[model samples]
Target: MHTAPQKFSRALTALAALTLAAGSAHAAAPSYVGTWASDLAQCKVPQERPEAPLVLQEKRFDQYETHCTFSSAEGAGDEWKVKANCQVEGDAQAYDFTLTVSGDTLTLTDDAGSQDLLRCR
Candidate 1:
């Protein structure tokens, strides 16, 4: 019972809705999901070494002698704060840190200081 133009209009509306859904889904993903190192050259180091890239997943981050597991990341825009339970040098620790992303670099600021990491391509 639909006219040709009417059907086309419905299709366009559906397409726009679908496009918006896709964009929102992509936006919901955290931008900092990747393996990162202090520099690109550091990516070549073995995981056992201090110079190894840090591997960050949705719920965890791992480096040479440090690992942290957290429930979630919370923030808007380019910065997110994470409260993580961590293990450093075999000692359990709690850490509150902020992760900021700029292009292919991630800067993590903790109580110690800020460390800049380059995304491993």
Candidate 2:
């Protein structure tokens, strides 16, 4: 009960549907292009200086702009900014770091030095 013309038409229709679905799926994905900021306590610090919290803000991926406000428990605070490159690890959406990630820590480097940003969930 199947004709060659009908088979060809059905195949074309299926192909068209597949193409449309693929295009829509690609378009619906969110591009990581915004400024993300988090509280100072969210970032992990070195064990020697564990009493201080660091505020971190990242703007633009290509031009990694970070603002940090680190304050010691005793009411001392220091702020700094560093420009570098950044990228996301694997295909994760919530876990992005600067281009200087090493081992399990995300690193930020500039004319000053490098700092590691441990991922905190």
Off by over 4 Å in 2: 1-98
Candidate 2 per-residue C-alpha lDDT over 23-97 given as tens digits, one digit per residue, 9 for 90 to 100: 987763111212222334534443234333332333333212222222211111122233333332222223222
Whole-structure CA lDDT of model 2? 0.39
Task: Work out the TM-score per prediction.
Answer: 0.73, 0.30
C-alpha root-mean-square deviation, each candidate:
2.8, 14.6
Clashes of each: 0, 1
Per-residue error for 114 in candidate 2, Å, reads 0.4
Q: Mark the regions of model 1 whose C-alpha exceeds 4 Å error after superposition.
A: 1-28
- Per residue, candidate 1 scores C-alpha lDDT tens digits across 1-33 of 999999999999999999999998876557888
Q: What is the lDDT of residue 63 in candidate 2?
A: 17
lDDT of 1 at 8: 100
